[model samples]
Structures are given as structure tokens and as C-alpha cells.
Target chain A: MDIATQTETAPPPPPPATTEQQRASRGATRPGDRIFLGLSRGSGIVLLVIMAAIAAFLTYRAALALSDNTGNFLTTFEWDANAIPPKFGIAVLAFGTVVSSIIALVIAVPVAVGIALFISHYAPRKLAVPIAYVIDLLAAVPSIVYGLWGALVVAPNLTGFYSWLDTVLGWTGIFEYQGGAPRSLMTVGILLAIMILPIITNVSREVFLQAPKMHEEAALALGATRWEVIRMSVLPFGRSGIISASMLGLGRALGETIAVATVLSPTFLISASLLDPGGGTFAQNIASKFNEASEYGRDALIASGLVLFLITLLVNGAARMIIARRKEYSGANA
Target chain B: MSTTAPTAQAVTPDTLHAARLPRWTSPLVAIGSAAAAVGIGLAAGLHSRVQWGLIAAVLFVIASYVLATAVEGRRQAKDRFATSMIWVTFLLAVIPLASLIWETVERGSKVFSPYFLSHSMGVVADQDPGGGINHAIIGTLQQVALASLIAVPIGLLTAIYLVEYGRGKLAKAVTFFVDVMTGIPSIVAGLFVLSFWILILGFDFSGWAGAMALSILMMPVVVRSTEEMLKLVPNELREASLALGVPKWRTILKVVLPTAIGGITTGVMLAVARIAGETAPVLLLVWVNPFINTNPFDGAQGSLPLYIYQQYAAGSEASYDRAWAAALALIGFIMILNLVARGIARWKAPKTGR
Candidate 1:
């Protein structure tokens, strides 16, 4: 009786002891554990530091360039950064980037989705496997190679098609072609469309393949044709997936550098017609001018790159947000 | 309201008949569309074969739908339309990409010789015919090696931390930033290194500067892929090791890591392939060299992609051929990497339930 009373009166044995024991059991007391943890955690911290450094340094250079700016940074159309006063702006860059990427997304997304569905659902197993493999291989083809091909082979071949577009869609101001080299924003858009196709198709194919098989079977059992089944079951389930996939493609299209640089004959003016061989994307502008750019000129280019960086960040962040939000009701967790 | 016998008979008849089109219907429509398209092209004096193809595809789709509707009703027609559209789109996408590959091989083969492979652009002018990518190949190997050296260990460790020990806010923040980093433009990455390493630190153009930028782009891809690979390691293995009184670090290193090593290696190689093709960073930082310089730390380097870009910019028939040849080499290198990575993945896939 006395021992029991003494144990009961031991003042709960101190809560810190439990946590300390837990920590020790977690291997916190061992040097190997502590060192490994520290190393890995430090690596994570370093990665974060690098990301932070990218933004910070870009912004710093951008600030230096912006402070001496002799033009409205967002609205000025000219880009004579190497001049004594150094007047430069991202107006043409922003317009070109957004417009060309929009065109790419517009041209790529539907066809990509169709191709994805064809591979995932419509194609026979033998054909599907090889085509999917081909797409994957295509994805690995370097952008520089694509750019080279676009310049040499594709760009020359596009003239006939551009003329056709011009004749048919000439009433639309954007299709007016005062043709010279066929190196224009429209060409960039088409090439980007081709570039982003594999990525979008790959992602959407995976999503379409993951659509609940039972839901598809349920639709089929109700006498729905293949198209109706896809409409009622697969498309609904894969909607958010398609959106995120398209956004990923858009992000790539917006930031694609060498390809745009190779294919676009950039000028400062944003022509109403996409067929005009003018207007500069941020990445393309940086690449085309960096070789000749002075120190301040480099900073001005960095300023433009900073914009491209922020735009991609926003686009990618929004894509992640969409995926995250959809995960809640996507039945994926279940 | 109808009697059960009549309703059942009606359903049976409808199910039995269902108005199917013959298998040859599609081929017939295709041939018809092609002829019609050719006739239309001739009549309209259309110069572009692309226009001919487009007209044929449209005609095929429309004709198939109309025939299906006439024979098999609206629902089957809709299905036929969708099927034809998907097939057309697939063909549309595949044709241009195939042409790209075909053109690369065809043009590249004209100048791609052992002589081209063994020499460098030491004496050849842009318009001259005799030059090789030996220097470029060396530069690319060194820079990619440097980038992989920097990226792999850090990326692997970061992924290990996230998978094995990550808990609260720091882990969350790291994960988020890794995603953000993945989308950083290659050119932007170059700009960052330019601003920090070159502009502020007063560093000269070197392969080392380019490697730093390439590593920045490579690190995120490495981390993401390694994280995925690490996550694939079953929890049972880790738990079993811990239950044996092994320290958590040892368990992760000896048990979890070995089990996941194949996938991790594949991820690293794939990351290497990706960085190998990067041109913007090299363009910005490495500043091209025509002659072979083995020392990346001291001087400008010649890389395959940069070589291609420069050659293309030279705007000569000879340079264009050189560009195509270099592109072929780069593509072959990346394709080999991808194929090997995938081969490893298949060979070392986790033996679940075996």
C-alpha cells in the first residue's frame, strides 16, 4: 500500500522525459543519425537558397537596369538598351510572349488531347504502345534540334501554308502576311505548338488511362457507344488533368528560348499581324541580344528575363494549385 | 403503357440489328476523299500539298459521318466522327514530327563522316566545308559531367530528406520551391548565374559558369525524380530495418537506398540528358569557342548545341550542313541516354509480391 501511494504521488514523472525518450528512440542521440539528418536537411536548405538566390539576383540586376530607365518599362516599345541613356522596355517582349504562347496553346491543346485519347483509348494495344514510345522519344529530342530543324526545314516549307492562311484568313488582321522569310510569331506559335505537343499528350494520356475503369464500364454497360462513354465518364474525370497538362505546355511555350530565337526575326514593334516578321519574346530577346549587350544592356536583358521568370512561376504555381484543389474531389486518394 | 411481350420483342429486334457498317466503309470513304481532294486541288489550282491533305482529311471525316448517319443513325455517326477525328489528329501530329526526324537524318548523313567526327573547327571558316565537332563533344562532356557532379548528390540528399525525415514547415517550403524551380526558364537560369556569378562576382565566361547555370536547371529535375523514386520504396523495408534496432540513418542508407538505387540512377541520368541539351545557359555563360579547350574552368568551351546554334547563325550552306550533323549527334546522345535510363528502370523495377 505504501509503495503504490508513493508511485501515485511521483508528480507524473515529468513530461520532458517522454519527449526525450521519443527523440532518442527516433535516433536523435546517435551521431550517424544526427549527421545524416543534418546533411540531408542542409541539402534541402541549399536548394531553397539557390531558388532564393535566382530571384534575388535577377531582381537586383533588374533594379539596376530599371533605375536608369529612360522609358516606361511596361509600355515602352523600343529596346535601345546599349545607348548612352539606355532606354529599354518589355512591352514587345510581353506582348509577343503571351500572344505566341496563347496561339501555341490554342493550336496544341485540342489536338494533343485528341492524340492522347487516341493512344489511351482508341488505338489498338500494339499501335498504342509504339506510338506512346515514339512520343516519349520525341519529348527527348532537344529543343535546339527542333529550332535548327524549324529554321532550315520547317520554316521554308511553311511559306506555302502561310500563303494559304493569308488568302483564306486575310480578312482577320492577324493573318495578313507581308511575306519575306516566314520567320514570324505565327511560325513561332506553330513550332511551339509542335514542341509542346508531346508533353501535353503524354500527361493527358496518363490521366486518361487513370480514369476510373469501373465508370467507363458502367457507361458501356448502359449501351453507350465509345464516344458517349468517353464523353460521360473519361472526359469528366480527366478535365482537371487536361487543364493542368495544358498549363504545363503553356509554361513551356512561354519560356522556350532557343527555338523562338532561331525562328523569330524579332523587332521591337508588335505588329497587328502575327505573320509580320517582328516582335520579341523575353527569352528570345535575351538570347539574341546577350552576345552584344553591354553591362547595362545585360542588366536590361536580365530585367526582361525576370519578367519571364515571374510569368512562368505564376503559370506553374496556378497549375499546381489546380492539381491540388482537384485532388480533394478527384477520388484519387480513395 | 405497352404490353411486356411487344416491348421485349421490340428491344430484341433493336439489339439484334443495330445497323453496323461494313469494315470496308472507312477505306472506301478514305479513297473517295482522296480523289475528291485531288480533283478539288486540280480544279482550284491549289499549290500547297498541305492544302490537299487538309481538304482530304476534312472530306474523309465529313463523308464518314454522313455515311454513318445515313446507314447507322446519329449515335454511330457521332462515334465514327470522333474516331476519324482522333485518327486524323494523330496523323497530323505524327507526320510533321516524323518529317523532322527524317529530314535530320537525311541531311545530317551527307556531311556526317568519321572525318567530321574526328576534327575541329580550328581552321575552317563558316563557309568552308571542312570542320568537325570534336572540340564541341569534349566541351559538352566536361560541362555535363561538371553539372552532374554538382547536381546529383545535392538533389539526392534533398530528396532523401523530404522522403525520410521531412515533417513540418521547412519540408513543405522546400517541396513547394522545388516545383517552382522546375519551371524556371533555361534562359532565366542563365540570367541568374550571369547576374550573380558573372556580373557581381566578376567572373569571366567559362564552361564552369555555364555548368553552374545548367546545374540550377538540373537540380530541380533531379530532386523531383529522385523524390518519386524514393517514395516508391515500400515503407515495410524501412520499418523492418528500424524494428531491428538499426538507426534510422543506417536503415535508410543500407535498406531504403539500395532498394531505390536503380530508380535514382535512372533519374540522375535522365537529368543529365536534359542538361546536356540545354543551349541557353551555355550560350549565355560559356561563350562559344571554335578550338577544343579541355579546361572548362579556364576558358570558353565548344558544345554541340551551341555549335549548332552558331553554325545556323552563320547562314551558309556548309554551316547549315554542320548544324544538322551536330543536331543529329546531340539527338543521338539524348536518345541513347533516355533508352538506357528506361532500360534500367525496367530491369530494376521493384519486385513486388514476388
Candidate 2:
């Protein structure tokens, strides 16, 4: 009732036009102001120019590679981008990258949410803060370190699990293991899932912490149990936030180079079986092949990099849009 | 006899409170579930402890739910189940992180020494592996410091523009592109530098090339964080300064910047932490040289991440030890940066910001 009365009596903000008029009247008009503004504005334009240069350069290199190619750039599976004819394509890379990232997302999101919920809702007050801090530290661990851990420890340990999955789901064909080492997409996905867990957990934890206490208390006061209160109050409020956090994680997974490169054995073929030894992602392919590749081959790799760039850009943009829209709605409602 | 009957009738029962389980009951329930899970795992002969752990987690959830349903109600049962699931997930996440840190420290301490920290790999063979990260340290510091020097001012100015003077389409475009830039893969940045600088201009592989790519990655992170910090500087201070007839630039330099400097430093430190561990761009742009090369513009250079990769790729006992040690060193450096940055953030937090 107090909240209701406060809302009822509080005045709304002034309209944009009047605020602009007021600010314009109050603005400082002087040479120093003008010079300072000009410098800062130039810096902003410089950043825009850098972005334009990156896109233009990448596209120009990609076009150079595509123009000389006799093979289809999008569909062919070969990657002999340095041969006399220089045939190459992104079909296998695209499939493996998307599949591996989706696998990582599927495995990470639920576990991350559970950990976030535990930290925010279930943990004792003293334990939650340290746990959150530890998770932050985990997020800052270098990707190369994760790559080393994944290649040496995690991959070997997963051999038994891979065999088990193969026996259990072998008829599905995708999980079939040939008793080789576990340097496959499945391993990379699992490693990536681990690498990104801290990020998703941290973001979701913050959102869960911000769940409005009034609504939660109202639910509890209605004789609802803890789970019932959460279902009625918390999850609904944090759904969009969770989506945005997961998107951020997905962007990271798609662009991850070292971990995937270090974990998987790359070849130029598309295998339906992710447990097999041969798959390549765009970033991994570029990093691994760049040292040995000819000029033509480098351009082809750049072409694939352009695709990865576009994908991550779209994902991060969507996440930002969702967060911004929610901000506006919450602001208006407040 | 009549008095006794009246006294017995006077002692009426107090039945308002509902019956409940004792506090000890929940712990008792957990112990029972654990015992049951161990028995089942043993009976089934599960080879891996992971399988046993998973079984225990599942059984705990089910047992808690069933017990709660019987003793309390359906809703409470669900709540208990969720709590158990969350605990299990938290443990699952902690297991790997602890293992990674523990493994790195355990192996790394075996070879780490002051001598190891001071000597370069100039005289060490790949298999002999008695080398230190001295060269890598020099390379990492010079590259990261150079990258920071290049990125910070530009990022700070851009943030100022966005926070103070931003109005229309141009600012919005800048904001959007910065977001886009944030997601650019380090490998792509490496490739771009490789093309524009090396392939096109015919420059040799060098630390400066790596610095350029790293600065590209560093700028966006710096911009976003600095923007948030600048926004937190209250407008009232600016108004007061302007009201005193101080020039706008002077006011911003004296008042606004000083107010936000602590947070800006934290942001820059965080950005540094991120770029310091970047391996992909360094791998592509600065072709790793095992020996020390001091010049940034002249020749290939060594870096910590590239050192770790090279040592691990060598596949020998001594090489592995060196890799682990260098990795430990890198993690320590990064962790220090993070702790200091967080400390600054906590220490200098604006009174009203929280």
C-alpha cells in the first residue's frame, strides 16, 4: 500500500523537448568547451573508422579468395585453398562450429542457471558472497590455460565416458566412438561448456539477486512454499536476463579459438558423428592453418573469419537490444 | 473423587499448533540418502567416482522430495528438490575450477624458482627444458604496456563523448559499432593485422604487430567500462564547476576526471588482464621465437601464452614442467591484476553509486 501511494503521488519526468530546451539554455558556450567537445567527438569517429576498416579489409581479402575459386564458396567441402586451382569452402566449418556451439549451449545453460540460483537463493548468506567471487576469478582464468587443461586432462578423462555414450547410443551414429582418442567435437563442446559456465553463472546470479523482493515476499505471505514463490516471482522476472546472458556465452563459444584448436584434431571433412576425430571451426581453422598457409589460403581463412565475425556481431547485438528494451519498459513502469 | 474428575477436566489440551518434523530430521534424511547412494553404487560396481557422485545427487534430490512431501507438502517437497539440484550443480562447477588451479599449482611449484624467473630460454633445448619465462615476461610486459598506452586515451575520449556530449545518430552508431567490435575474434584481429601490416606492407613478424591486434581488442573493453564509470560522476559537480565560471575543459579535467579516475584505472587494469593472456593474436602476429629479442619492430618475440603452447607441444617431462610453471606464472599475474582492480573498485566506490 505504501508503494502504491508513493507511485500514485509521484510526478512523471518532463518530456524530452522541454528538457532539451532547458539543457540548451544552460549549456556552456565557450572556446574551451568547443575544443574539448571536438576532441572527444573525433575520438568517437576514430573508433567508427576502425570498425569500418576492419570490415572493409576482411571483405576485400575474402572477395579476393572467392573470385579465383572455381569451387562453390558456401557449399563445397574441400579446403585446398593454396593449390593451383585453390578450391575451398566453409560447409564443414560452418556445420561443426554451429553444432559444437549449440551443444555447448545446451549443456551449459541449465547447469549455469542452477548454480546461479543456488548462489542467489539457496546458499547461506556467508557462503554466497565468496562463491560469487570465486566464480568471478574463474571467469578471468586465461583461455590458453583452459586449452592446456582441456587437451591434457579433460580429453583423456572423457575417453571412458565417450565409450559409454557410444555403447549406449551407438545406433544413433553420432555418438559412435572408434576407440581413438577423444579429440572430437563432443570433447571441445564439453570443454567450452566448462570455460563459459562462470560467465553465464555470474550474469544470471546478478539478475536473480535483483528479483524484486516485494513480489517474492507477497508470494511467501500467501502461504506459498519456497519453490512456489520462486516460480511465481523470480523466474518470470529473470527470463529475459537469462536469455541475454546465454546469448553472450554463445557468442564467446562461437569465437573461441585456442580451446577448440587445442582440443580437436582438425581435418577438412564433415562427419555426422561428433565423436569422430575430424572437425574444424572457423577460428580454430584460421589459427591452425595461418602459419602454414599460402597467401591464397590466408585469404580463404579470412573469408571464414568474416562469417564468424558476422555471427558473433548478430548475437551480441541481439543481447544488447533485449537488455535495452527491458530497461525502457522497466523505466516506464517505474 | 468428584474433585479429581473436575481437575482432570480443567486440564484441557492445547491443539492449535500443527505437528511438524524436528530440525534433526532433515540431516538424518541426508545421511540416509548418502548411505543408500553408496550402497547402490557399490552393489552396481560403478567404476568411476563421477558415476557414484551423479547417483548420489539424483538419490538425494528424490529422497528429499519424497520425505518433504510426506512430512510437509507438495510445494515444500519441490523446493527441497530444487535446492538439492542447485547444490549438485554448484559442486559440479567448482570441481573443474579447483582441479585446474590445484593441478597447475601442484606441478608448477616443482620447477618454479628465482633462477627460473631470471634466465631466458636462449641456452635451453626443447627437450632439456631448464629454461625460464624471463624472455616471455619481457615480451608480454612490453607488448601489453604498449597496447595499453595506445588504447587507453582513445578509449577514454570515446567514453567521454558518449557520456557527456552524445546526442543523436552518430553516437548511437559509435555505440553499436563498439559492441560489434567487442565480439571480434582475436584470431580475426590477428588476421587483419597480418594482412594490412605484414602481407600488404611487407613488414616482418614482430611484437608491434601483436600489440596492434591486442590494442584493437583492448579498446572496446576499455570504452564500455570507462563509459559506465564516467556516467557515475554526478552532474551536480559539473554544474557547480560551470557555475564558478571555470572553463568546461578545465572543469572536466580537474573535477570530472579526478572523480572517475579510480574506476577508470580499475577498468584499464581489467582490460590489461584480458589482453595479457591473449594467445591467438600473439601466435599469429608475433611468430614465437624461443630466444629473447628486445626489439618490438625488428623480429619475432616470445610471449607467456605462446611459451605455454610451445612447451606443451614439445611433449616431454621437462617441457611439461616448464609449461605448467609458465602457466602458473601467467595465472598469478592475471589474478593479481583482477584482485587489485576489484580492490580499487570496492575502495573507491562513489558514495551514491551503490
- Most accurate candidate by lDDT: 1
Give me the overall lDDT of model 2.
0.86
Tens digit of per-residue lDDT, candidate 2, span A227-328? 787788988988998998899889899999988888889988998888988889999998888778998898888889888888888898898777667766
lDDT of 1 by residue, B145-234 (tens): 999899989999999999988989999899888987888889999999999989999989999999999999999999999899888888
lDDT of 1 by residue, A1-334 (tens): 1222343445466876765554545465589988999999999999999988888999999999999999999999999899999998888899999999999999999999999999999999999988998877777888999999888888888877788789999889989987788999988999999989998999889889888899999999999999999999999989998999899899999999999999999988988999878898999999999999999999999999998999999988888778667767766624
Cα lDDT of model 2 by residue, B1-354, tens digit: 778977776696445644456778768877777788789889998788888777767777787788788876776778778777788788888998999999889988889999888888888997995889899998999899989988998999899889877889999999988877887888888888887888778899999999999999999999999999988998888878867767767878898888988899999999999999999999889998878888888799999998998888788899889988999999999999999998999888765534
Best by TM-score: 1
Candidate 1 at B120: error in angstroms? 1.4
User: Which portions of model 1 miss their true places by more than 4 Å?
Assistant: A1-24, A331-334, B1-15, B39-48
Docking class of 1: medium
True contacts kept of 1: 0.83
